[model samples]
Target: MFKVEAIADSYDQRVVDVDTGVYLEWLVTGSRYTTEVFNLVHPGGMIPFTTSREYGVDPHTGLPFLVFRFITFGSAVRAQLRTKHLINCTFTDDLAKKFWMTVAAEALVVFGSAYNGFKVPNRRYTRVEVNEKIYTLEDFGYTTSPG
Candidate 1:
């Protein structure tokens, strides 16, 4: 049996747009990986954005999966945190834990690429439970450069 639980932690950063300052917090969760971006500086909640994905069964492997999803949204109204985006990818059970962990790191790099000035710290945890015996593992860095 192949059963694992993964959690993507959240991070916050303070960004300024010329004169106005805003706080941005990004939260990611779910077995399939769902990301939520919020603008704490503004009174209103989540900002609106466009989401698109390319997902289906691989023609060669014949396995169902989501290749990637792109989220494009505007940053704070006045802050320089403009044009923030996230690229989310799904890893299937066939892939090893290390492979998925590397993929997660790549996703983080892509998400923070726009805001090079700011830093975003991310973490991934994989947990396995069998017959009430639980094992927890964490991956902070990738063995190979996710490039």
Candidate 2:
């Protein structure tokens, strides 16, 4: 419910193309392209946190999650929050960013790398060919070395 409303309210509206021509001496223009899909079902926005539930203590043990097993308009929900995926934080849809990031870090660890700040990677990303392009890590952003 909240997810539907949220995406409708906020989405990606990008300009694909601008077509301009003279139609009957009148200028006709239009834009083309595609679409907002935000993983914006955040901690508190969609699913309620501990403070949002009936009581501070979670009705369902462990982390909270959205229940999509059954969709019932008037059905009674035992617990406002679901803790099914608490063991591993897989409740949200995300790219393999975490896993890939760890792999990238391994490169830095073995070869060693520097940081911009105390322990911050560089602002720019590093684009390199890996495994003969079969397993390339494109635009490895947040690099430690500038040059």
Q: Estimate each model's TM-score.
A: 0.23, 0.15
lDDT of 1 by residue, 9-119 (tens): 624332322232223333332234443333322332333222223334546656543322324343322222453442222224534433333333233322332232112
> How do the residues 1-147 of candidate 2 rate in per-residue lDDT, one tens digit apiece?
000011135452211111221001001111220110111112222221110101122255443221111111111132222323211122234344333233322232222111111122322121212232311112333233222
Candidate 2 Cα outliers beyond 4 Å, as residue runs? 1-95, 114-147
Q: Indicate which candidate wins on lDDT.
A: 1
Stretches of candidate 1 exceeding 4 Å from the true structure: 1-50, 71-105, 108-147
For model 2, the run of ten residues with the poorest summed lDDT: 21-30
Q: Give me the overall lDDT of model 2.
A: 0.20
- lDDT assessment of candidate 1: 0.30
